[model samples]
Target: MRAPCERSERHRSVARRRWISRASWACLMAACLGGAAPPFVSSVSFAQQPGARQAPPPAVVVEKIEVQQVSNPAQFTGRVEAIEAVDIRARVTGFLHSVDFKDGQAVKAGDTLFEIEPDQLNALVASARAQVARADATRISAERSLARNRDLLARRTVSQATVDEVQAAFDVASADVQVAQAALDTAELNLSYAHITAPISGSIGRATFTTGNLVGPDSGSLARIVSLDTVRVAFAVTEGLLVTIRQQQASGGGLDPNTLKLSLRLANGTDYGTPGRIEFIENEIDPQTGTVAARAVFPNPRHILLPGQFVTLYVQEKDAPSLPVVPQTAVLQDREGRFVYLLGKDNIVSQQRIHTGARVGNGWAVTKGLDGGEQVVVEGIQRLAQGMTVQPSQGQPVGGGT
Candidate 1:
């Protein structure tokens, strides 16, 4: 056996020779198999080199520009109201005698609602009539005395002062009759007021004062009545839009009070079929809210629109102007700002920042950044980098129904 150092050198030399022989065999096999040997050799090579990484492409959908009709109707929140609403209050102070109408019942103008006890008024009227009868008897006696005095004055049997006294007595009796007649009229008026009557045709609300309850002229409202044959919807127009409204009115290009068309949607999302016209707009804008009050009248024949009901108002006008719009999916947000991917002629995606306005259906009105004819990537933006080349397909959006 050799020394220890000599033994180590002999083992290294044998290992090198073995590696050389294995490499030569591999080279010969690769030459024979040519292209077929690469996969197998690559597998062997991959085993030696570890930690290789693979990246995936982003998946998305897209859309193109198409011409369409766009409407920019003024939008506002409003409330349904009766054309006229009045609170029923007692005209004279007295105990309520009887209630004539049921709660929530439809009423007509001059319909009796509540009957107050008119016993005192009736007594007063009867007393006034008696006084009138007494005055009539006294006047007859004075008239007979006056005629005798006039005859004696004509015959020079009495002085002028005596005739004047008799005439004055007759005049006093006639004046008393007029006074009593006025008193009777007052009593009659009071009795009529005792019967609470509706001032306007409407539907009566729950009674605040019932039978035997004391009510007075100065008392707060006893009940409420709202006329629903025609209803008004009150809404506010923002100060920003006020200028546009005025401009439209001044141009005489859009609907005026007579020609304007209006519609309403109920709280439950049902549309009021009868279209309305703008009745009036307030002269001044509200200083507190910076909005102008506008009223539109709708025919409520069936009394469907009730007072105090919340409603959404849609004031329809002629077509506005056309605006550029893109699918909502195309819009993307990041820390920088809102953006979308634009596909170039080479099927590459480029980042584009956009300024948007009102949303029309499922698309946004692009005010800035994108123009007509620019293809925006509605889908597949996530799969792309700023400069990465991508395969683009005209992605059809799922649903965009009106």
Candidate 2:
């Protein structure tokens, strides 16, 4: 029952609102799609920029490889030994009268060390001398009697038997004289033994027997003396090392064990001022140890090296011929082996495997795998990779340079 014109106007208004809502939805979808599409496109463009133009490689410090003479030293641990060690002992039976030297005093050869009771020995010597005189007088008297008997026999004043008897008596007296002379010499020798003297010139240890103490051949060492002006160092070298040394000598490498120079480091970690030379090598290898015994002589003018002290011995070899060398910092080890980074043309880093020898100063002696005149990376190695570009700068030369 409503008006027809009002109903028609309401329907038209509903259609217009629906059309505006559809149009607004389409515009919102288009805006969201446009914003999302730009970021995807921009990401692709940004990645492509790096591909077109690469960044410069990381910077590193490098040194040119050079060959130089290097020294190889073999080291060993050894013990210091005295050139001469003597023990003082009494050679005869006597009561020690006095000690002539202080404890631990240095003494020269023939220095009096102790004096035993000489009273009894002196009396024996005197008694032997008196007996010798008595024997001589008796022999003279017997000889005179024999001569008188012989003259009497020629003149027929005495019987031939009496002459024979006198001659026999003279012979007996001569034999007695010889016995007395032997006894005197024995007594004199015994007296000499009563005074103990140092047999060598060296520092002596404490005396085991004091004044008034009984010391004789039965007693042990009275004291000990060790010569320190020249000392010896003894060390054992393995059979393998001994073989190597022999091989070097046979090859005419100019390594003579007798003339090899040596140096020592004391237990206190100080270098001995004087150098030494190899003196003796045992003729036979020790069966128990399978090593050869070697000794070196060192002049210990100041007596700094004492017996039983431990020290380190260094044997320097002749300078090896010049060889390729590189900074130790440039040497790297991995599962493969020892390798170093070499900067080649186009500033590209490549791994170079190397055979390293003895350390020469702060660098390594490269025996193989690297020729001379190659640039080796010394710094910033951790940032390096195979075939990676690098910015190399000149650094200190390795192995003292060319």
TM-score of each: 0.68, 0.77
The pairs that clash in candidate 1 are: 58-383, 60-379, 60-380, 61-378, 61-379, 61-380, 62-378, 62-379
Model 1: CA > 4 A from native: 1-69, 247-255, 318-359, 364-402
lDDT of the candidates, in the order given? 0.81, 0.89
